[model samples]
Target: FLFSLQRKSIVAVSFIAAFLCLIIVRLTNEVTFPLILNCFGQTSVKWIPFSNGQRQPLRAHYGYINVKTQEPLQLDCDLCAIVSNSGQMAGQKVGAEIDKSSCIWRMNNAPTKGYEEDVGKRTTVRVVSHTSVPLLLKNPEYFFKETNTTVYVIWGPFRNMRKDGNGIVYNMLKKTVDSYPAAKIYVTTEKRMSYCDAVFKKETGKDR
Candidate 1:
């Protein structure tokens, strides 16, 4: 009986180990496959045949939609440096170093004009929140007209970003585009926002 019990314990341990290995494999695949796909420009977006029987490339980056062209945002970069507005970078003086990256991402309304020594002067992309839209509008010339080359990605709750003529932020963005045709602006799709929330929950074991 003792021998049988010992055998059972060993089997249980082996089973647990196998389960852990499976979980690790799944996690690794989830994290790595998306990156691989992005690197090869084979993201979730797929090519579809047009009405004229011609296949068109529907390029997208994680479900971000370009407001002007009404197509998916197509962007690629070798390296990206995300500059935060946190005070921790006050004396870092990493501006020149950050500027060396192929792409520089900034958060909403974070002005680099005054803090060019710590934050970088160049901005390839700017992720803005719905609440910060008005703040940006306050300086429309600086944010939309001046930085026309920079891509703008906006994120917010569905109510504020919806397109049924009820989304305040969406309407504002539409007006901004009409005002500055050269501005490159994109908004996160509802599905993409849900996916981000799912990822956050999966990683932290808590709802985002």
Candidate 2:
């Protein structure tokens, strides 16, 4: 009877070990493989193909020298503060308050040095307009190179956003890239800008 009991216990332990091994193998096949592939997969946006054999130009084609090479911004934060360039923020002594957030956002080449009492010194992101490109380019070394390290998201109309080789702002950015290699800039596509404008118009009854 003692011998039989020992044999039963050994069998149970072996069966349990086999079951755990099977589970680990299944998980690796189903979950781990795909995750590994996704991690190292091609991250660049593919050009759209047309029936007439012409392919839609990518944003990189518009003269964004390092745009394609740039990795997408990944945020994992609990709080974010979007600070716009509105006149109302001029007098507010909320710099200390704004600095508390995990991420701080500002807009359109706004000066933060003198206005540090109102606006915080830490700039996580900057939302720039198409019209502001020329101004930013004029002092790229100060804004983009020397002092600020803010991520810039430039938005504009279809003509300026398009990658059709005639995009004025796109050309400007291309030239800026040649001039300033250290700046981090991302320009929005025409379709995305149009959608945002439509949403803004619907919400405020005014064109963006």
TM-score for each candidate, following the candidate numbering: 0.70, 0.65
| Candidate 1 per-residue C-alpha lDDT over 1-208 given as tens digits, one digit per residue, 9 for 90 to 100 | 9999999999999999986775455334333345545666666544443443544443458589888888888666678999987989888999999999988999999998888889979999999989999999999999989446999999988899999999999999999999999999999999999998899899999985
Candidate 1 — which residues are off by over 4 angstroms?
1-59
Q: Please give me the total number of clashing residue pairs in predicted model 1.
A: 0
The sequence of per-residue lDDT tens digits that candidate 2 reaches over residues 1-208 is 9999999999999999986775456333332344433454623323333542543322222312234344444333457988878878888999999989977888888878888889888888778889988888777776788456776778888788666788898788777766677677777755667778999999999997
The predictions' CA RMSDs to the true structure, in order, are: 13.6, 11.5
**Model 2, which residues run further than 4 Å from truth?**
1-71
Name the best candidate (by TM-score): 1
Candidate 2 structure lDDT:
0.70
Q: What lDDT is reached at residue 65 by model 2? A: 24
